[model samples]
Each structure stands twice: as structure tokens, then as C-alpha cells.
Target chain A: LAKTTQPISMDSYEGQEVNITCSHNNIATNDYITWYQQFPSQGPRFIIQGYKTKVTNEVASLFIPADRKSSTLSLPRVSLSDTAVYYCLLNAGNNRKLIWGLGTSLAVNP
Target chain B: EAGVAQSPRYKIIEKRQSVAFWCNPISGHATLYWYQQILGQGPKLLIQFQNNGVVDDSQLPKDRFSAERLKGVDSTLKIQPAKLEDSAVYLCASSPGTSGSPDTQYFGPGTRLTVL
Candidate 1:
């Protein structure tokens, strides 16, 4: 499993775009970057996933550079409901055990 | 479509007591997973099951923890002689297929266990 590091927390206001970056410098070539959102007392929900370059869904977008050492999860037009802990996982494809980091808590303010 | 379902939303038992958690996955899902989440921490994988077979359980404490996915539909995680460290939320998740499919896992509300 590839280890990931992200900021401890972030704060943003409604209608603003929030970007959280994760670093996995030793990421393997076969690794895939996936992001999940977790609310208090609820299970984590999938946001977006990507192997490289960029991937976008109805909910969020994932950006990966050529080096693939890091990735960023971009959320558009955030709202108070978007406040939650976000996790970035690496090598989710091959590793049965999806090692999760502490995650970056995003607090969307009014 | 119905999502994953878990039973006994909460449980409180004394140390050395045994407890069990149940889960029902969505129809047609082939992969099931059990995770333990400690407070303020990300969930840790306890076991992974493909159909009725075990795919991965390296993180599971076989001596005290056991899980089974019967008929590949429902699963049960049991902890015998539970310890204080066993107090945590047991989450059940299921995906459409294998991890290679990039299948998003649907999770249940989880069973919160409190061992005193």
C-alpha cells in the first residue's frame, strides 16, 4: 500500500471552490489515486478516482500530474453540506487493503 | 436500489464477552469488506470477501475476530473474548466487482461496539 499525506484541515466558504492535495512521493506506477468523503457517523463515500492526468465526475474532479507523485481533489461551488473529512488513497487497484490516512477535514462555512 | 445494511446499530458489552455484527449487501455485488474505524481515524480493513470465499484477511485478528459471507449475500463478523480495544465501529461495504473494476463501495450505517 502506498502512503499518502494531506493537510490536517481546511476551511472554506459557501460557493467557493475547494482543492485538497495529497502527496505520495513513493507512489508506484500501477497505483491509482482515489478520494473519499466521510461524514460524521457515516461510512465513507466515493468522490473521484484517477490513475493519471485528470478525471471528472458529476460530483468532483481529480487532477494528477505527470510524476503521479501527488494528486488533488477539486470540489466546485462548495456548500455547508460539503463539510466533511476527505481521504486520498493510493494503489487502490492492487491492494486489497485500502490503507486510509487520517484525512483532511474540510469545513464549509456559511 | 437498496444499499448495504448492518444490524445492531450499537452494542455495549463487558470485556471477555462475545458479540456479532451482521450485514446485507446490495444485490449483485460480488465483493464485500469489513472495516474497523476507531474514533477520529480512517477505517481499517479487517477482511475482504469475494463471493463466499475469503480474498484477504491479513489484517483480521483470526484468534478473536472472524467473519463469513454466506452465499455471498449476507455477512457476519464475530468477536469472541472481546477486549477493550475491540470497541469501535464495524462497517460493512460492498462493491459491484473486484477492486480492478474501480467499483465504488456502498457502505452501511455500521455497528458501533463498546467494550467495557
Candidate 2:
């Protein structure tokens, strides 16, 4: 099983870029770093995933260092609607446990 | 394409009672997952299914919780003798089951279970 650690909360204003970092000191070799976003009363939605280096999507970007011990999710020009809890996940190989720690609760203000 | 679907949207039951949640994954998807999300916490993977077979259920509380996916299209998660701590949002997710790598999991709206 792999574990992730993130900040409890973050605050950002609209139109600003936000970066949420997660630490996984014991991450495995075949693990992939993934990020999810969740609003109140709804399920999480996948934001970005990357094995190493950087992976960018329409909504967000995932940056993983070569050591694979940590990853960062960046949201460019965030808006009030981006207010949600952000999760960092370590997908550790097959038949492995998926760990979803208490993620960073991001509050995007107007 | 439609995403994962779960029902009923909300459920309320007293402790010691039993309640069940149903989920329908996206059409043609071969992987389904069930997760439990308590308020103010991230979603925990309760079970994972590949087609009609279970890939993992290590985190599920087997003493009171049970889940099954027959025919591989839909799944049901039942909690017999529910407890107050069982109150949370039950989420269902699905993936394309791409070989060599598991694709992204698309989540549903989730079913909120409130045990009083």
C-alpha cells in the first residue's frame, strides 16, 4: 500500500495560479501519480496523471520529480468554481491498495 | 458517453438496519470501483472489480458490509446492520480496462447514505 500527505487547506483568489503539492516518501517503482478534485455532495473527478516529469491536460497539470517522492498539481487561472478538495493518489501497480488521504481543501474566492 | 450512474441519490436508515446502494458503470467499461467518502475526507476504495471478478476488497469492512457485481454491468453494495459510523457518500467509478495500464476512473454523482 502507498500513502500520500497533503496540506489541510489552501486559499486562493480568482484568476490566480494555484499549486498543491503531495508527498509520498515511500512510493513504489511502478506507481503513478494522479490527482482528483471534488466539490461538496459530488464524487471526485480526475484532474491529471503522470508517471514522471510533467503531464498537462485541459484542466490541470501534474508534475512529478525524478525521485517520485512527491508530485504537484497546478491549476492556472483558477476561478470561484474551482473551489473544491484536491486529492493526490498513488496508484501502486496491480492488485495494490489505492490510498486517498485527506486532501487539500482549496477555497477559490472571488 | 454517459459516466457512471448510482442510485438512489440519498438514503436514510436507523442504526441496526440494512441498506443497499446500486451502481451502473459506463457501457463497455470492464473495470468498476466502489468507494466510501466520509464528510471532510477523501474517498476510500472499498472494492475494485474487473469484469465479473473482484480484484480487491481489502479495505471493505466485511463484518457488516458486502458488495457484488453480477453480470459485470451493475453492482450492489449492501450494509447489513448499519451503524451510525456508516453514514457517508458511496461513490461508484469505472475505467476502460486498458491493458498494460488501468485508465482513469470516471466517477458518478454518488449516493449519500445517512444513518441516524
Off by over 4 Å in 2: A93-95
Pairs in clash, predicted candidate 2: none
DockQ of each: 0.64, 0.60
Which pairs in model 1 have colliding backbones?
A: none
What is residue B40's positional error in candidate 2, in angstroms?
1.0
Worst 10 residues of 1 chain B by lDDT: B96-105
Q: List TM-scores for all candidates, in order.
A: 0.96, 0.95
Q: Candidate 2 lDDT, tens digit per residue, A55-106?
A: 9989998888889899999999999999999988887434247778889999
Could you tell me the TM-score of candidate 2?
Answer: 0.95
Q: Which candidate should be chosen as best, given DockQ against the real structure?
A: 1
